[model samples]
Target chain A: MPPTEDPDAISKTPPEPPAPLAFDRPAFHQQAAPEFACALCGAGLTGQYYQANGAPVCSDCRWKAEHESGPPQAGRVGRFGKAALYGLGAAAAGTLVYFLVLWGTGYEIGLIAILVGWMVGKAVFSGSGGVGGRAYQLLAMGLTYVSICASYAPMVVQGLREAQAAETTAGAGAPEGADAAQGSSSVTRSGSTESFVRMAPNGEPDSQPLTQEEMQAALPLPDDPEQMQPGQTYKVDLASSEEELSPALSLVVFTVVVAVIALAAPFLGGLENIFGLFIIAFGLFEAWKHAARPAILFEGPFSAGAAEATRAPALPEAAEAHGE
Target chain B: MASSADVRSPAPGASHCPACGCESPAARLLCPRCGALLHRRRLEELAAQATQAEAADRWGEAAGLWREALALLPPGSQQHQDVGRRAAEAARKAPASLLDQPPGGAGKMPKILGSLGAVGVALWKLKFVAVFLLTKAKFLLLGLSKGGTLLTMLLSFGVYWAAFGWWFAAGLVISIYIHEMGHVAALRRLGVKASAPMFVPGLGAVIRLREAPADSLEDAEVGLAGPIWGLGAAAACWAVFLATGSGAWGAIAKLGAWINLFNLLPFWQLDGARGFRALDRQQRWLAAAFVVCAFVLSGEGMLLLIAAVGAWNAWRSDATTPNWRILATYLGLIAALSWLAVRVVPMPT
Candidate 1:
C-alpha cells in the first residue's frame, strides 16, 4: 500500500504548527512566597536581582552566563577538506561546460571564465556550511584558476592535432624538395657567416683583400637532393625552423608548451583587450568578496536596573509584600 | 469595583485582584476573581522572545511580541515606555506588503491558454508597455524645463566636445541626460521627491533624492530605471546606424550599450547592486542564469561580470521575498544591452 493512502501514516505526520508568538505559552499564575529566592541560583534575593531570559537570576549567575561563553568555534580542518572537495567538483563541472560551449559555438567566450569563478566560490562556501575565511577564499581563487586553465585543454589539443596533420601532409607530398629546402637554407646561413668573417679582416693592417677565386668559393653551394645522405641526422637548431625533432620528442615538447599556454590563457586573453581585462578582474573580485568572512555586530549588555529605577513607586503594603 | 489602592496592593503573601478586592493564597499567581497576572514572569518571557525575534529579523513577529509585552507592563513605567518604543521600531523595520504583492494584474496571467487567450495576454502586456513608455516620455519632457539641467547639460557637452567631435559629443550628452531623466521619471511615479538631473563634466549625470525609497523593491526600480532608459537610447542609435549607414552613430550606440552594461555590475553604489537587493536566493540564481544565456548568445564579455556578481549575491544569507517583475526587468535589460554592445561597426575617421 502507498504511504499516502494509509490513514495512520497521514495522521502521524502532523501539520506544521504556526510560528509561536512571544507570549504564546499559558500565563504563569503563582505568587512568590514571603521568602524571596533567586530563580537561577536558589539564593535568597535581598538587595537586587537580575532577569535573564525572563527568570530572576542572582548577580553572580547572571555575570557568569553573560561572560562564560567564548567566541564562536573556529572552522575545523574537516570542514575545509569538505570545502576543497566541493570546489574541485564545481571546477570540473565549470570546465566541462566552458569547453562544450567553446567547441559547439566555435567562439571562445571569456565570460564563461567568470562563471567558473562564481561556481567554485559558491561551492566552497556551501561545502564549508557558509564558513568563510582567508583559507577558504584562497582555496576558491586557486580552484577557479584551475577550472579556467582546464577549459582550454580541449581547444589546445585540437589545435595541435590540426598542425601535426598539416605537417605530415607536407612531409609526405615532396620529401626531396623538403630536404633540399632545409639543406639550401642551412648552406646559405653558413655562407653568410663565412663572408662576414672574411670581410672583417680585409681592412686590417696585415690582411689583403680576397681574390676572385676566394670570393667564388665563399658563395653558397647549389642544393642537390642526391647529395643528401640517407638516414643522416641533422643537429636541431633551436632558432631555425628547418630543423626537426623526432616525432615522439616533438610531441612531448609540444604538449609541455601547450600546457603552459593553456595555464596562461586567462591572463593572455585579458591582455588582448582592455575591457576583457577589466571584466576578468571584476569576476575575481566577486569571488573574493563572496568568500570573505561575514561580520556580525552585537549590541551590548543593556542596563535593566535603570528601567527598574523608573518604575512606579510601590505602596507601603506592596513594598512589604515584594520585599523591595 | 476595587479602588486603585486595592489594585496596587494586597495583603502580604496573597495575590491582589485588580477587578475585585478578592485575595488569593500566596501560592496563586493570578487573581482567582479576575485572572490578572500576579507575577512578572509572563511579561519577562514576552520581552525575551521579542528580543529573539528581532535578532532573527522576524520584525513583524518581534513587533507583535513587543506590543504584548507593552500591554502587560504598568502604565507610566519606564519598562512600559521602552517596550512601546521598541514595538514602533520593529513595525518600522517590518517588510511592507506593498513589495510582497506583485503590482498590477500582469502577474496573474493564466498558465494554460488557447491561441486567442495568449494573444489577449500579449496585447494586454503590450498596452502596459506602451503606457509605461508614454509616462516616461511625459517625465522626460517635464525635466527639460529645469534651468539647472539645461546649463549642466551644455557644460558636459562642451567638455566632451574636445574629446569627441561636436556632433558625437552632443549625442553622448543627450544619451546621458536621458539616462538621468529615467531616474527622475521613476521617482515621480513612486511619489518620491527628488532634484532635477545635474550633469558632471566627466562623471556622467545624477539626481538627488529628497526622500529615500519606502522599501528595497522601490529602491531597485529607481536604480534600474536609468539603465533601462540608457538601453533605449542605444537601441535608437543602432536604428539610426542601420538607416543612415553612419559609423559615428554605430559608435555612439555601442558606447551607450557598454556604459549601461558597466552600470549593471553589482557592486558598491552601482545601479545593479541596488537592483539585486530585493531578490532572494532563487531569483538571484535565475538572474545569473539569464546573464549566462545572454553572454552565450551575444558573446559580450560584460555580461560575465554581471553573472559572477549575481552568483555571489545568490550565496548571501540576507534576502527578501522574490519579486518577479524586478527579475524580468533586470534580465530583459541585460539581454537587450548585451546584444546592442556586440553589434560591431567601424568608427568614423
Candidate 2:
C-alpha cells in the first residue's frame, strides 16, 4: 500500500491527477481537510480566512503562501518575454536621461549609471514572474552595458567634433610666408591663465591688446592681482575663455578614465589595477548569482513559505519513490 | 460570540505574533497584544471603523484603526504603504481639542509624555528614517558588496589625492587595501566567510567577516595578518625608494610603515586589541610594556594612551587560550616590524 494511494481501502474513490511537484502537501490533504479551517496549517479560523489555492487559509498561513510560494506556473515564458521587454524599455529610458544630463552638465553622473543597472535588473527580474536564471542575468548585463555606452556616445561625438573644429581654426589662422605647421605657435596657458602669445618677427598684434584693468576684470581674477609689467601688453579674448575650454577638457578626461578602466583592467598587473579588475569580475559573478534571481520584492503571505518548505522536503522522497 | 471565543482560546503553531510582539497567539484571526485582527476580513472592518471614527472627528481612533489595517498587510505591497501613509496623515491631522485633551485617569505629566512620545515616534518614522536608512545602506554597500567597496575606496582615494598628491594617496590606499586583503586571506584559510575590503571615505578600509572566527587565536591571527602584510607593502615601497632615491617614495614608505605600526596599537575596534585578546596575562603585560617603551622612544602621546587602554582590555578579557607557538612568532614579528619601521624609514625634512 503506497502512501499516496490505498487501493484496498477505497475502490470507489474518485481518481485525481497527481499533485504538483513544487507544492504537493495542499493537494494531498485537501480530501481530508476541515472546511472553514486554514488550508495549509489546518488552524481553526476565528474570522474570515484568506483565499489561497482554491481554499480558505488562516492569516499566518496566507502570509506564508503569498511570500514563499512562487507565482502561478502558467504563462511563465510569456512573463519572461514581458520582463525582457520591460528591461529593454528601462535601459533605453535610463540611457536617454544619462546622455541628457551629461550633455547639459558636461559631467558624468556615475550614480545614474548605477541606478540604471539596478532598475534594469529589477524590471527584468520582476517582470519574468520573479524567475531568475543565467539567461536573465546575461540579458540584464547586456542591457545595462548597452545603456551606459549609449550615454557615452554623444560625448564622444561632441569631443571629436570639437577637436576637428579646433584643428580647422588653427589651420585657417596660420600665417603665410612661413611653414604653417611650425610657424603655428600653440599657446599653452599656465595655472595663471596667461597665454604666452607668439608675435611675428615684424611684431604685429592680431588685435588690440586690452589695458591692465580691463585684463584684470575680464578674465575673472582672484583677489589682489599683482601689479602689471608697465610695458607688456595683456590680451583678453571672449571666445577663447577658460569657461569655453572646460567642457572639452572634462569630456576628454572623463572619456579617457572610463576607457582606461574598461580596456586596461585585465592587462594591468600587480597592485596597479588588480583590485579594480577583481571588483568588476566579482560584480559580474554576484550579478549572475544574485541579480539574476527574481526577487520577491512585493510582500506576499507567509503560507507561501510554509508550502514551499514542505514541497522542498518532499522532493527527495518523491524522487526516491519515482526511482523505486 | 466568535470574538469572545477567540479571547478564550489561543491559536496553536503561531506561538508568537510578529506584528504585536505578543507571546500568546490568541485566536487565529486576532493578535492579543494590540487586539488587532490578523485576518484579511479585518481589513475592511478596520477601514470601515476608521472611516466612521474620522466622520466623528475622532482622529486618534481613526489613526489607530488605519495603523492596524496597515500592519495586517504585507509591507511594501501597494495596499500596505498606502494605508501606512493614510494612518500617518490621520495621526498628524488630530484636532487641537484632542491634542490638548488629558487622559481620563493619567495626570498632566503622563499626558505630556504620551503626546511627546507619539510625536517622537512619528517624526522618527518619517523624516529621520529616510536619511538614516541611507546611512545603513552605505554600511550595507561597504559590508556586503565587493564592487561597491572597491569603488568607494577608489572614490575616497581620489578625494585623498586632492588634498595630498596622487603618489602618496595612491600608495596609502593600495597599502591599506593590501592590509585588508591579508585579513581576508587569513579568514579564507580558516574557512570563514568574509567580504572583500571596503573603504569608508575618510576612515580606512575594513574586511567584514560574515562569520566569527573559530576562536580567540584565529581572531588574533587574522588581526596580525593585516599588519604583517602591511609591513611587507611598506618594505616594498622602501625598496623602491632605495632603488630610485625618490623623496616621494621614501615618504610613502615611511607613511605606510607608520600607519601599519599605528594599527598595532591595542584599542577598541583596532586590530591590536584583537591580537592582544588572545595573549595570556603575562604576555599581555609584556606587550603593554613593549608598547609603552616604543611610545617613549617615539614620543607619540596618542600611541601611549591607545596601548594603555588596549592592555587594560586584554588584561580584563577571559578569552580562549591561543596557540603558544603562533603567539610567540606573532610577537617576535610585530616587535621586529615596529622597531624597523621607526628606525629604518627615511623621512625627508
Candidate 3:
C-alpha cells in the first residue's frame, strides 16, 4: 500500500546517522582482546577472569601464581658470606671515620654511632643484592658494634701514654740504687709501673745497685735492646729511662693493652652512662632493622571498577563537566 | 521513521559490529574488524547479571557486568549510554561497600570483646603489638631520602636554630621530620603517590598527595601515621633522657610528645580530623571520653582543646561505620602520648 518496499533497495540505502551518546564511549572497546584463553594456563576463559599484566588469567592460574611463587631461597649461604665481607669492610671504614671525627672534634658524637650502624647495614644489604635476612642482620649489628668500640682505640692509647709519662716524671728523682732494685722486682712481678706504684707505699727495696746484666734480666727486656757506648755509665732508673731503653717495644705493648681496653670500652662506657648505652642500642636496632628482610603484605583482588572510577576523565566533554 | 526493532537488529543473514560498525555474517559470533561480540543475546545476559548484582548490593560485581554489557552495545545507542552511566555509578558505590567490610583479622574477634568496651579493645590489640612495631620500623626505614627532604630539613633547622638554639632546634626539627615522613610512608604503602617531606620553618612540614585516598579508612590511616611516628620519636628521646640524665633530651622528649599530642586535636585538616572520619557516632563518643580521661589524668591543657573538638564531632549526626582497629590505635596513642607528655617534665636546659 506504501508501494511494497523493495528489501534490496532498503538495504542499499545508507543508514541514518546514530544519535549522540549520553556518555563517553567505553575505553575497553578501543583495545582488542588478546585472546579468549587464559594467559597462564591456555585454558578457555568463559567466566570470571582476572588480569595480570593486562592479559586474561584464569582463577586457578592466578591462585597458583600468588600462593606458590616467592623469592628464591637458593644461594642464601653465598649471599650471607658476601654480606659478612661487606659488613666487615664497612666496619673498618666506619671505625676509621669515627676515630678521625673524634680526633678532630675531640667530642664523642653519639649520632656517629647511628651512622656507623646505617653504613654497615647498607653495605651488607648491597653486598647481598638486597637479599636481607636474620644472618645479614646479625652480621651488620656485630660489625657496627665492633666499629663503634674500635673507634675508641686511639683515645685509649693516648690516655695510657699520658699516664705512663706522668708516672715516669713522678719517679724520676728517686735514689737510683733503691728505685732500680724496686722497679726491676716490680717490673718482673707485674710487668707494669701501675702495679709497682700500688705496691710502692708498702714494699721495702734493696739498697744495692744491680749490675747491668742483672738489671736487664729483672726488667722486661725489649726485643732489640740499645747497645751501650764503650765508656758510658748506665743508670738503672726503670721508670724514667724505660722509654729510652725500649721505646718501640713499649709502644707495641701499650697498643696491645689499649686494643683490649678499646674492645671493652663500649660496654664499660655503657655501664657508666646509660644514655650512651641506649644510644648504642638505638644504633644497633637501626642496623638490625635495616638488614632484616622487609615484610611486604599484598592487599587486593579488587574489582577493576575501582580503577575505572579513579581513571582520568580523558573525554573532552567529561573533562569539561568535571572542571578538569 | 525506523521502528526500535529495526534500529536494534540488523538485516536478515547479517549483523553489524557494535564496536567498529563492521557488517558480518550472522553465523559469525564476533565482529570481523574489531572482534567485539556481535551476539545481542550475550549483551542481554550481561545486563541481566548486572541487574541481579545491583539488587544484591554487590556494587563491584554490578559495575563489572555493566562494563561488559557496555562493550557489546553499539556506541551512542541508548542502551550503551545507559549502561556506561550505570557502570560509573556502580563504581562510585563500590568503595562504600568496601568500607562496610571488616578490615584484616579484627573482624574475627568475639563480639563480646567489642561489647566489653575500650579496655577489652586494648587487650585484644595486644597481639598486634609486634605488627604495630614492625610496621612503624618498616615505614621509618622506607621514608629515608636525601636531596629535597635533607635540604628542606636543613632550612627548617636553620630557622629553628635561630630561635631555640641548636640542640633543641635539631631535636624539634627531627621530631617534625619523623612526623612528616610518617605521612609519606603511609601514602607510599597505600600505593598513593606523594611528595617527600618539605619543611616550612615554623609551619611544620608537609607531603602533598597526588591523588585522593579511595576511602575514609585510607584517609584515616594516612592521617594517624604521622602521630604514630611522632610518638615513636618522642619515646626514643624519652628513653635517651632516662639513659643520659640530660635535661636537653628530657626537654626534647616533652616537647616532641606535646607536639604529637597537639596533632591529635580533631579540627580542620589535622590528623585527628582524618582519623575521626572513620568512626561511627558511638565510637566518636568513646574517643571523646578517652580524650577527656587523658586530659584529666595528664593535666595537659592541649588535651582540653582536643577533647572539646572530639566532643563536638561526637555530637554531630554525620558518622561512619565503626573501625575498631583505628579506634584502638587512636586510644592507645592518646594514652601513651598523654603519659609521656605529663611524666617527662622538660628540665631546665
Model 3 bad stretches (over 4 Å):
A1-324, B1-146, B346-348
Writing each residue's lDDT as its tens digit, candidate 3 over A1-324 gives 477978999999998733333222332323433345566678865434454443445678766655654434777788778888998998888877666655543445565687788889999987777667677888899889888878777779788879878766765434344444543433222333422211122234433334445433443333333443322223344455454637888678777788789878867753244445656776798789878664432222222221111222244534344333
Per TM-score, the best of the predicted structures is: 1
Q: How many backbone collisions does model 1 have?
A: 2
TM-score for all predictions?
Answer: 0.41, 0.33, 0.35
Judging by lDDT against the true structure, name the best candidate. Answer: 3
lDDT by candidate, in order shown: 0.64, 0.56, 0.66
Better of 2 and 3 by lDDT: 3
Shares of reference contacts reproduced by the candidates, in order, are: 0.01, 0.00, 0.01
Candidate structures ordered by TM-score, highest first: 1, 3, 2
Residue A118 error, candidate 1, Å: 3.5
Candidate 2 per-residue lDDT, tens place, B226-315, comes to: 888788778878888889877777777777776777677676567887787678776777667766776667654434554666578667
lDDT of 1: 0.64
Model 1 misplaced stretches (Cα beyond 4 Å): A1-77, A96-115, A151-256, A269-271, A304-324, B1-181, B188-224, B239-244, B251-349
The global Cα lDDT (0 to 1) of model 3 is 0.66
Better of 1 and 3 by lDDT: 3
TM-scores, chain B, all models: 0.60, 0.55, 0.61
True-vs-predicted CA distance for residue B233, candidate 1, Å:
1.9
- Tens-place lDDT per residue, model 1, A202-238, is 3321233333343344433224534333222122222
lDDT of 1 by residue, B144-257 (tens): 799999998887777677556688888888888888877776665555568999986655777887655545776788999999989989998999999999999999998898
